[model samples]
Target: DASAMDKKQKQFDKLINEWKQKCEDITVELEASQKESRHYSTELFKLKTQYEESHEQIEALRKENKNLAEEIKV
Candidate 1:
């Protein structure tokens, strides 16, 4: 009975260690994914700002072109 109990205890310990390692690995992966998400989010924000600025510049240029055309007709 004692030997059987000892074997069971060893098996339990092995399982516990394996579970702990799995938890650590999952935590590491979660952190890496979060970091990647933040990087992409920042890039997206920068691109959106750049697009807005470019759109404004294009609109301004169009207005200027129309005025120049009208002046030439006059």
Candidate 2:
């Protein structure tokens, strides 16, 4: 009876250890994913800013070209 109990205890301990290792691995993956998400968010913000600036420049150029055309007609 004593040997059987010892064997069962060892099995339980092994299972606990395996679960702990899996939990640690999952935690590591989650951290890496979070970091990548932050990086992508930062890049997206920068691209949005650049797009807005380009749009403003294009509008300004169009207005300038219209003014020039009117001057030539006169």
Candidate 3:
């Protein structure tokens, strides 16, 4: 009976260690994912700003083109 109890205790200790290792791995992965998310978010903000500037430029060009067309017609 004593030997059987010892074996059970060892098994429990091994399982606990495995669970602790798994928790550590998950924490590391979560940190890396958060870092990547921040990087992508910054990139997205930059691209959005660039797109807005390009849109404004395009609108101005269209207005200039229309004025030129009117002059040509005159």
Show pairs that collide, candidate 1. none
lDDT of 3 by residue, 38-71 (tens): 9999999999999999999999999999999999
Residues 1-74, model 1: lDDT tens digits: 99999999999999999999999999999999999999999999999999999999999999999999999999
Model 3 lDDT, full chain set: 1.00
Q: Count the backbone clashes (under 3 Å) in each candidate.
A: 0, 0, 0
The lDDT for every candidate, in the order shown, is: 1.00, 1.00, 1.00
| TM-scores for every candidate against the unseen true structure | 0.95, 0.92, 0.86
**Model 2 per-residue lDDT tens digits across residues 28-69:** 999999999999999999999999999999999999999999
Report the Cα lDDT for residue 26, model 3: 100
